[model samples]
Target: MSSVLLFFQGLEHSPLSVGLRASEWMYPLVNTLHILGIALLVGPILILDWRVLHRRATPPVAALATVLLPVARGGFGLAVVAGSLLFITRPLDYAFNTLFQIKLVCIGLALLNIALLHWSKAWGLAIKDNQFSQSVRLACGLSLVFWLLVLALGRLVGYR
Candidate 1:
């Protein structure tokens, strides 16, 4: 783990990373964009997740999935790009932060959970049966928990 952290510390000192560090405005601007990307990604996602949770009145799960999936993908894309820019600026600190690692793990799990939900091949059956399955609800519940934790850990990176 020490060696791995050293590697990230090395990355933080790279020419590009140094340039970002050297520029006062660049880092903050990029971070702001990264946060904006998160908003783009998480906001619509909660709505779809709400459908599964029975929190809000919306179209059926299958129909809502069709609409919100694209928006979530766009948000994920933006967050990835902006996050990359923000990450290199302080790789070492993030590499060692316990919460940061947890955040990363949660992100991986969140993505995996969504992929599994999509690949489950149950949506069509549930739709045809005119019922919502508990599996879908479970995935949405997990996604909600994981993403909320991710948000908290991300904020903790600054304080911890």
Candidate 2:
């Protein structure tokens, strides 16, 4: 057997994994937290994205970001931790699932989009001067698409 398979098998058989699977309420609670985490993460992002995309910039990008970014980070952290816990319950199955893999890729793309936006000169201009450049707008638009795809694929991962 491949070492990769062995690793997943080991994860499935670990004490925490076994306990979570065996528990009546623990898995459900964790699943609920995952949903809530996604809500928290995506809600802020969508709102911020919408503001950026809007023709009339009522609330400035920097103002919205200052309020939303921290909440998004908190949500992302919770989702990752909870998602990791859930993955261990059936590591082999999820590790091989196509939807799960796609979801991961979409998440990577979303993160990359965020990084590019933050690292670009346009981001600074948008925040400091209320100047929304083409690049910043494009990044925000792509962020909406990528994150929405990630959300959909995450749901589909279970159905597969």
Candidate 3:
């Protein structure tokens, strides 16, 4: 246990980690950016998901994705960067937190789902005809579920 603790002690005591811990203002600022990233990433995603689920009737999926995926990617950039900074402040907490682990797994599942969707024929159908197969609908449903779980687990990390 001491050896495991020692491993994180090195990370927690890093210069940047120490600085982040010491800065009263920066921590909250970075957290705010993380939330902003989540918003940017999830907002468009929800909109797209709504369309997939027949909850909306506006832009086609491919057109909407063309506009939104890049935005989500940009938000993902902000999230990973700020999240890394925040995680560095207390690596042990994140490393051990069950919810934190769950959140990471959910994020990975969501990414994998999207990758699989892109590789399927539904992607071409969506781009060409704005319609997709049942598999894509299932993927979209899973995407929504996984992302929502990630959000919940992310918030839960703070409780522990």
**TM match of model 1 to true structure:** 0.88
Sort the candidates on TM-score, descending order: 2, 3, 1
Tens-digit lDDT track of model 2 for 47-143: 9988888856578878889999999999999999999999999999999998899899999999999998999888987888777878888999999
Candidate 1 — worst ten consecutive residues by lDDT sum?
A: 123-132
lDDT of 1 by residue, 15-111 (tens): 9899998998988888888888888788778887777678443477667767778888898898888888878888877776788889899999999
Give Cα distance to truth, residue 96, candidate 3, Å. 0.7
Candidate 3 residue-wise lDDT at 88: 91
lDDT per model vs. reference:
0.81, 0.91, 0.87
TM-scores, each model vs. reference: 0.88, 0.97, 0.92
Which parts of model 2 are misplaced by more than 4 Å?
none
Task: List the candidate 1 regions with Cα displacement exceeding 4 Å.
Answer: 1-6, 55-57, 127-130
Best by TM-score: 2
